[model samples]
Target: MHLKRFTDFALRVLIYLALHPGRTISINEIARAFDMSRNHLLKVINELVASEMIITYRGKTGGIRLARDPAAINVGALVRRLEGQAPLINCAEPLCPILPACTLKQVLNEAQHAFFEQLERYTLADLIGTKQEKLVNLLTNHVAGGNA
Candidate 1:
């Protein structure tokens, strides 16, 4: 299944913070590292902070950091929060007359649930694991505001 850019960017932002965790990382720095627009990243960060997934600080020394330990934050839960009530297929919406006989929708629903189930087994910590150094450097050396 295809994830929206918002969810995709949010995951990247979380992973970066999970790997860093040393100090507050600037949105500009993160945008440069990921080669993504600071504006876009800002929106993603806002959503994450609103959901309590990450904490943001203002002022010159202020930046962003994860709200909790990466190991305790489930990937599936993050996805669900970031996606904000997305259904894998529009057909999954209730009250649709075709749902009773729509084999395609059923199959897609099953697949989506399976995907989420798999995500439930992992956390931000799992995603960063041994790759912390690589990810940190990747973020530090990010050019301008886009993915490296």
Candidate 2:
């Protein structure tokens, strides 16, 4: 199943913050580093802040930072929260005559559950464990360029 752009952006944001740790990173800076839309990132950031995954600060020197440690952020839980309850397939559609007898839906459901269970075993900390320096340099260099 393909995840939405919102979920993708959320994960990217979390990973970026995980790499930086204590530094307050700005939305513009993140957008620039990822070459993503600022408006889209803003919406993602709003949801993250509301969910208490990240904290925001305002004013001249203001920016955003992780609400908790990377190790404390469950990747699966974050995906579930952002993805909502949308099913992988529209099994209830009237167009499909074999909806009742088809095992595809059930099989897909099991697969999806397994997918999340696998993700549950990992945290944001696990994502940036060894790539911290590379990610940090990539992000900081973009910020240091002052092009955002």
Candidate 3:
């Protein structure tokens, strides 16, 4: 199943924050790092903040940081939260003729459960394992070079 752009951005924000611990980072910095739209990034950041996945501060010295440890943020839970609890497929959305006996939706449901189950086995830290320095350097250089 395809993930929404918002979910993808949220994950990227979490990964970026995980890479640079102990310091607050700005939306502009993250936007530049990923060559993303600041406006879109702000929307993602706002949702993440509302969910308490990340914390924010106001004023000139303000920025954002993770609300908890990377290991505490389960990938599956984050995805499910971001993706919502809606069924993966809507068998009766258009009034399908087999709506009364549709198994396709149930099959899709099982597959979605399996997908999340696999994701639950990992955490944000798992996404940034053994190469934080490399990721940091890549992001820093990408920003420094003003590629976007």
The lDDT of model 1 is: 0.82
For model 1, give the 10-residue run with minimal summed lDDT. 139-148
Top-scoring candidate (TM-score):
3
RMSD each, Å: 3.2, 1.9, 1.3
Per-residue CA lDDT of candidate 2, range 25-141, in tens? Answer: 888878988888999999999999999999999998899999999999999999888877676888667568888689988888898888888888999999898888988887778
User: What's the true lDDT of residue 56 in model 2?
Assistant: 98
TM per candidate: 0.84, 0.91, 0.93
Backbone clashes in model 2, listed as residue pairs: none
lDDT of 2 at 115: 82
Q: Which of 2 and 3 is ahead in lDDT?
A: 3
Off by over 4 Å in 3: none
Q: List where candidate 1 sits over 4 angstroms from the true fold.
A: 91-100, 140-148
Which TM-score value belongs to model 2? 0.91
Per-residue lDDT over 1-148 for candidate 1, one digit per residue giving the tens place of the 0 to 100 score: 7778998999998898887776798898777677788899999999999888899989999999999999988999888766665556676455678777778866887888888889889999999989889877655655523444
lDDT of 3 by residue, 75-97 (tens): 99999999987897777677889
Local distance difference test, per candidate?
Answer: 0.82, 0.89, 0.91
